[model samples]
Target chain A: MRASRPGMSRALVRRETIAGYLFLLPSLFFFLVFVIYPMFMCIYTSFFDSNMGKDAVDMFIGLGNYKELFQDKIFLGALKNTAIIVLVSVPTVCAFSLWVSSAIYNMKPVFTSAFRCIFYLPVVTGSVAVTVVWKWMYNNYYGIFNYLGKSVGLIDSNINWLGDPKYALWCIILILFTTSVGQPIVLYVSALGNVDQTLVEAAEVDGATKTQVFWKIKWAQIMPTTLYILIITTINSFQCFALIQLLTSGGPSHSTDTVMYYIYYTAFKLYRYGYGNAMGVVLMVIIAILSAIQYKLGQTDS
Target chain B: MTTKKSALYKIIAFVLVLILALLFTFPLYWILTGSFKTQKEINSTSPAWWPSEWTMKNYENLMGKMKAPLWEVSVPFSQYFTEDGTATVVSAGPQVPGAIRWMLNTIWMAVAAMLLTCLTSALAGYALAKKRFIGRTLIFTLIVCAMALPKQVILIPLIREMSSLKLYNTISAVIYPIVGWPFGVFLIKQFAEGIPGEIIEAARIDGAGEVKTFTTVAYPMIKPGVGALAIFTFINSWNDYFMQLIMLSSTKNLTISLGIAKMQAENSTDYGLIMAGAAFAAVPIITVFLIFQKYFTKGITMGAVKG
Candidate 1:
């Protein structure tokens, strides 16, 4: 009887293994063919001098495209712009969403969810719609910003919000900020709820002020959430493509060019497939490194 | 004194959040009102906070831009290599408004993506979460790493892959990539972990087959996760503009957002027409989101717990 039980259990394990793989087959098929293949092609094609012309041929000039990427002034400027975007937006998005979530998460449930819904409106509105509306709002002659500014005596003249090299990138960043906060706010609210209530009350009774509690106990508890938010927001900002594409098209003298936009411009517009893929590879490395660091920090915390 | 001060601070925070919410929603508010505003009002230096005269001219202009059939009936996935000059065809259907056609295309794409993502993710996530199998940790780790990487990084190659598969310029090109994304699976796995193994063991001991047990036992338990994934995938794939822009070009195939973008590009400063297009694209999705807001929120939160 004991031998039969052991053999039968082993057969069950085998059955589980078979069923597990069968369940995984469909998802794995799509993942392998679509994601894994392209990821490989992205790296492989980066080494060749490829173009979109039917008559042309791909020439393997290993490291050549990578070499040109560093020297390309427009690309370097775009890198700077992308860097600026990541630096400015990640911290601000994390801070802003955290602040809004903290403020409303403790409110009446109706009011809390209402506010959450409202803040998420822009994201739900979709980028093309939101971008066009913002484009109108930033119009030099008829913009609400200029009108409101003049009415409030904040400025003497209508500033070309999307036209000027100075303000173009900032305007794109502003739109990105509005759309990006929705997910983080959603995430933060849940994270706040998940924080242990008893620990928070203990801190309060032990004479920790609200600010101290937020900075110490609550903050420590939500570090993983914060880290997760940080990495996601970082990825989001790095891929700021739509707003730039619609609003400025990398704008007045390429001042608003992000690496993502530049990649689109190069590969699709200019037909420099190899060069664009090289840029893609670089971007992937940079993001992977940043995420790795954040992930490791998150790992060490626990 | 402390209580009073804290109450004042609470009030201040409430007011700030309210104001910020308004500011954030202002663009959508503008799109809604601008679509109904007069041309003169749209161009006026002093912007109209409210439309002075409401009219349907924008929608009229938008609808009149290009004429396509109101709806078309065709075989799903009938695309194949035709020897007769690309004549591998599906049966065609009636004439439709170009705008409504775009809406249909967008709806079809989003729904297909949602259904596929939920089905595939549920099965895979259940296996990963419940069934002890070799390479489970490795696969999960790979999914997490891939999810961290932005989807756009592989754009160049995806275009090539889609073209090679004869899916370029078709809805399938857009749908497959979104389905292929592993975030949905990761999310479902998180939710699926809550399923008790004892139930599955009991079902198996009760003589239920594997497929039968899964369909009857695992599926119902994971329905909420699937719901969240459905809503999330729908909203996201609806707004997946970049992929659509590259993949689908024919007027009839353009998603509503792409159609709006095309109209805006052609008539850059024609705010009224553009707003009408914007309104068409934004309002429906927003309505869907509002209706399923809880599922959407659950979709966002489910993946990040203690991560």
Candidate 2:
């Protein structure tokens, strides 16, 4: 009986393993077809120069695409633009998101719940309609903002909002910052919920003020979420494209031309699939490196 | 003394929160009011802070303009023109039929994509979460890695592939890529972990098959998760413009975003009509959010908490 029992258990384990693989088949298949194959194809196609013209032959160019990218001023401009947005926006947004989240965490349930909903509405409402409305409101000559500013004596006259090369990128940055409350807010709130109530009460008993409690106890407890928000915000800031296209299509002089946008423009508009793929490879490397560094930092911090 | 200090802090916090709240709320208020105002009123040098006459003219004009499309099947083509030699652009009323058709197309595509995503994610997530097998960790790692690869990197190859398959300019082309999302499976798997193993085990011991247990116990436990996933998947598919724009070349297959964009670009100066279309496009999503706010919160909270 004991020998039979051991054999039966092994059979059951084998059956379970088979069943698990069976369940995983569909996802694995799709991933292979849709993700893995395409990724390989992207790399493969990058070596051959492509033109939209039917008569042209695809010339095999070894590292020629990469070499051309070094000299491509448009590609370099996009790289610079992406870096500027990420460097300027991520830190400020992360700080504000954390602070606002903490403040809301302290408020009463009714008030805080309403605030959460209002803030998250933007995530669902990032439509061209909203963008258009904002564009109208940011109008240089007749904008509500300019009108209000003049009424309050903050400016002498209409400040061209989306027209100027300098202001165009900044305008996009401001809009993006405002619309991106969903992830950071949700992270802070969830992290706040997991905080040990006992520790908080003990700190209170020791007469720790709210600020001190937040900085000393709550912040430290929520470090993982903070780190997560920082990494995601950094990754996201690097991928800004839609609003740039809508509000200003890489602007008066391609000042707002982000790397991803440049890739899209290059591949679709310019019909240089090989060159675009080379840029894609570079972008992937940058993202991978940044993610690795963030992971290391997170491991150390923890 | 402590009471007085606490009171002071409370006052400061209240003022700060109120200011922030007002700042956020003001733009929405401005837009809502702007929607009500006439173009002349909206463009006036000293714009009216509030509509003095309070005409429903904007809504009326939008609705009247929007009607020509629905009636196009009944109305003769020549009836669209006026008696004068001049072309009456307003008589035809700006292709409202096309806009309605695009809205339907968008909704249908989103529904199909969401259904496909849910089926695959649920099964895959359940397997990953509950079953112990070799290569499970590797699969999890791959999914995470896939999340890091932005859609831009893949669009070129995907477009090329779609064109080769003759699926370019079709709704299926837009939705097929979205159905295979790694994020959906990751999210569903995370939620599935919260389900106790005992229930599944009990069901199995009670002579219920694996598929049966999945249908009954596992499905009920993950119903909230399914709801959350549906909303998110729908929204993502609906709002996605870049992929659809590249894949869809024909007007017949254009989704709402692409359609509206085309309209605006083609008729560059038709501000009123474009606003109307934008308003129409925004309604479905806003309604969905309001109705399913709790699910959205749950999905977002769960995803963020895990991250």
TM-score of each model, in listed order: 0.95, 0.88
CA lDDT, candidate 2, residue B183: 80
Residues forming the 10-long window of minimal summed lDDT in candidate 2 chain A: A1-10
Q: Which portions of model 2 miss their true places by more than 4 Å? A: A1-14, A52-56, B53-96, B132-137, B194-199
Query: What lDDT does candidate 2 reach at residue A149?
Result: 88
Name model 1 segments beyond 4 Å from true: A1-14, B73-79, B83-90, B133-138
List, residue by residue over B1-307, the lDDT tens digit for candidate 2: 8789977877787678667767665555555566566777776767677766555665555444322232112223322354532223343324455667678778889999999888888888888888776678888888898887776688788887875565667687788788776887888888889889888889999999878988998888777777778877898898887888788866656777877677666744444455566666776877888787777777766666543
Q: How do the residues B1-307 of candidate 1 rate in per-residue lDDT, one tens digit apiece?
A: 9899999999999999989988887888899999999999999999989998999999999988877766555544445545322324355556666788899999999999999998999999898888876677788888887887779978788998887676777787899888889988888887778889899889988999988988999999988888877887888899988889888988888899999998889999899999999999888998988988887888778656613
Which residue pairs come into collision in candidate 2?
none
- How does model 1 fare in lDDT? 0.88
- Interface C-alpha RMSD per candidate, 1 decimal: 4.0, 4.6
Give the TM-score of chain A, superposed on the true chain A, for all candidates in the order listed: 0.94, 0.90
TM-score of chain B of each: 0.92, 0.78
Residue range A48-68, candidate 2, lDDT tens digits: 897655476878998899899
Local distance difference test, candidate 2: 0.75
